[model samples]
Target: MMKLDGVVAFSMTVEAGSISQAAQRLGLAKSVVSERLAELERTLGTTLIQRTTRKLSLTASGETFLPRARRILREAQEATAELAARSGKLSGPLRISAPVGFGVLHLGPALGRFLRDYPEIDLSLELDDSFVDAASGGFDAVLRHGAVGDGRLIARRLAHSRRLLVASPAYLERHGHPGTPGALEQHRALLYSNRTSDWRFTAPGQGWSVIRPRAALRVNNGLIMRDAAIEGLGIALLPSFFIHQALAAGTLVAIDLGVQAEGAELFLTYPKDHGAAAKIRAFGDSLRRSFGSPPYWERVEPAPRAAPI
Candidate 1:
């Protein structure tokens, strides 16, 4: 019989794409993970994964075995969770993934409180700004802002996210604030993620408008972009949670675009096929409660607007 630990090691390594990453996710040493993978292969009498310097790929046997391995792990986890549920107590390892900025600014404190309430639950959190598939990534839940693009995941709405264009007082002071969408083209655009060379906004009477922003710097991280905007490098479009403190302190000023900027609803998503694990339900409840009925970020004072044209 294959040891569950060995199976877990192999499956986790495949999900994470590397032994080092698997070790990080599993909270085990890299050497320990490697040894377990080697031991598992020895027991199974096959080389499951093709190892290389740049990447790891699954061999024919490994590819065939991956689905079964995941199912086994899920079944074991569900069995354990079922018993914990029967005891009327939530306990077990709950792995989660979240975007970097919102996770740190908002979700981190909320999760801290949840952990306080449930001391027995061990939590592993991965903070990433890039796209992650909760099922493939081995995460029980993912806290996401914007669209939950995958249909395979069940998403529960947590709160609304508001985004807007903003810039430091110093930058606006030197360059002059943009009074219209057309005016934005005159200033430097601090592009984030896929924004690239253009920003699309809804114009009141004219409908959709595209502003081609001159970019001197582009970054994939929201926190870095927020900081860059605050440093007077350029105007940026950012979610409220990311720039609320900066806005309050008058370090960054919101530009009144006369229409909503780009944003989407916040969601806590889990694999639809996995059902509602006790931990996922528990965390989702905590998120909805802590985020408030209107969410804290929405309470920020609105920017002064020039009357409708």
Candidate 2:
């Protein structure tokens, strides 16, 4: 019988494109992964991988064996999931990937509750702002906000969040609030560096207008940009989830430019075949329950206050 561990290591290495990355994903030492792959090759009586100082390539046998090896892994997982579902018990490791801000602000608490509910399940959550490929990264699921264009993955809408233009009361007091989108050019903007285009908005009467704010400071994190705006740095266009508390507390006020900002769709995405997996289903259901129909953040409407002097 083929060793399942060796097969998994070989498959993960091929998917990740390097032994180091596979090792990191598998939570194993590089030497251990190498030894497993070598053992697998020895068992098969063939050279599976051609490794050199600079690069690693698959031998002819490795290329031919990869598809079957992947099938074996997939079948084993499906079978395990089926049995686990029948027993109504969730076990095994569930790996998840999520954006840093959302993970920190929302998923952290939600996952805590989930773990308490399913003690048998081992969960590993990776928080990163960079985009992660769910299939290749070996993640069971990924929590993301915005469009998921990958056809291979299945996306379930968790909730919706809108972007709001906001600044600290002190900042707005010092810098006059803009009455319109066009007026945003005059203000010092604290921009989120990850956004590809300019800020855009729409109103009932007005169509759509885009403004590229003169970035006084650009940061990759939404929380940092929101805090900087609160520190009286500059106006920031940020997601409501990040600013809702400040808005409610009157520390940050929304700039009513008479236009509605674009809303973002939060999704819990996973491999289509893995949808029936106990852990993925349980987590997805938990997220849907936690966020609810309108989401908890959206329920806290920002109080209206007079424009700062």
Candidate 3:
């Protein structure tokens, strides 16, 4: 097989117009360049250049080979330039995985701004409730609710997500609000299958306690459970961010504001030891800046009075 090294050496030598010039450009010894050129000539069984005291000139055979050599060098130069640009610039496809509801409500708009700022970057986003294998799935990064278990994957806390027990005014009117956690059992509740049946609470000057409510419907999606609660289906336990708009609009009310689950968090994760992968870094930084400081996700959404229909 013809080695790219020899071809590269020949190309550089021709462009540089001397073995010494090619060596200087390539950071190789002049002797090494001369040997590679000789080997290339021997391999092709043709004398490509004639050496003179003043300057090196291409022979008849060299004239034909020169163009092809320059073409190869040009292609190689382009490839190198492309790779360097990719490494430094926030350009190319970045695959990201996130939870369905969060992606649609929060991340979607954020990504829109990110795309605007980095028009060169192409995004491949997948939102689902199921666990994702970032490495195996060729994902550049992932945003997950709660702390991750895998120590191999790297994670950065994007926000502090707090879970809340909430219900609609209409449902509370029909069922009445439970003043205590134990009182929840008397009321209908919409629960997620992924969450525990027991709900936690804390009152003024009281320690945390857990209570299991009587479920009206068990669901898998937080958005659906939230929607059901908004439409007066039942009380729902959900992350504060999911129902922020609803809560602000007076469509949903936080039932137990003084309690939370143990060790709940939200994270943006990616593979470790990835140094200066431009697209990933840009996206990660953009996320960090977007949810900067205490994190917008952790902010409590106030209940706005219902507007007249």
Candidate 4:
């Protein structure tokens, strides 16, 4: 095969007017550049450069070979750029699975931007509450909360889900706010079916404790939990992403129970064995950037505190 490394060295050395300048341009040592010129001349069976103390001059043979070497360098660069552009242009079937509530509520804008940037990406997004197996379900990536289980998969965390204990002004006014976790037993609890009656909480000084609130309503979806809380049905524990808006608008007040539950994290998981596909990486990066460090949803302004009934 015709080697292009020496060809590049020779072309740059000529164009740069000196070996040192050529090395600077090529990001290689001057000695390495000289060696390349020597090796290239050896391969061509001719002295391509007349090296001296003052400057470098091309031999008649070097002059004739110089044009061909420069042409070779251009071709090599064009070839590299073509392959790079092809790789940069990510396009393929990108199958993904996510929880229905999140996908519908928050993922719309992110998905829109991704589609605009990569129109060639044939996107297949399945919004379901259940955990979907990326390998068996033929999904390229899966958006999941909590823990990512499956040795076959590699996970990238998107954000930490901040759970909030919330109740509407009406509900608090009617039932009175519970000041302590233990006092929550007297209040109505709207539990998520995915969650248990045993809710865990902790504080910087208070340590960890489990609060088994009585469940008045249990549903499989977060929206139902949120809406029930909004409608003054009961106090609901929900993700900050789902209720930050209501909290900011004063439709719901964040109940500080003197402790906080550790939030489950959101993850973008892909098959570890399938190799990192361009489309999957692109989508994952987009989501991460959208979420940012603290996540855009968590940026809500602090809501007004509800007073005693």
C-alpha lDDT score of every prediction, in listed order: 0.83, 0.85, 0.76, 0.82
Cα RMSD of all models vs. native, in order, equals 9.3, 7.7, 12.5, 14.4
lDDT of 3: 0.76
- lDDT for residue 46 in candidate 1, whole number 0-100: 98
Task: Estimate candidate 1's alpha-carbon lDDT, on a 0 to 1 scale.
Answer: 0.83
Q: If ranked by lDDT, best first, what sequence of candidates would result? A: 2, 1, 4, 3
Answer with 1 or 4, whichever has the higher TM-score: 4
lDDT of 1 at 286: 80
* lDDT of model number 4: 0.82
Encode model 4's per-residue lDDT on 130-183: one tens digit a residue. Answer: 768876777878898887778888888888778989999999999998988888
Clashing pairs in 2: none
**Considering lDDT, which of the candidate structures 1 and 3 is the better prediction for this target?**
1
Poorly placed runs, candidate 3 (over 4 Å)? 1-88, 201-208, 261-264, 275-278, 297-301, 304-309
Model 4 TM-score relative to the real fold: 0.70
Which candidate number would show the highest TM-score if scored against the true structure?
2
Model 2 local distance difference test score: 0.85
Q: Write the per-residue lDDT of candidate 1 for residues 1-309, one digit (tens) a residue.
A: 688899999999998999999999999999999999999999999999999999999999999989988888888977787677656577778898998878878877888888887778888889988888876778888888777778788888888877789898888888887888888888898888644556778855767677888886799888999999999999998888888888877888888868766675888888865833777877877888888888888778754433322
Better of 2 and 3 by TM-score: 2
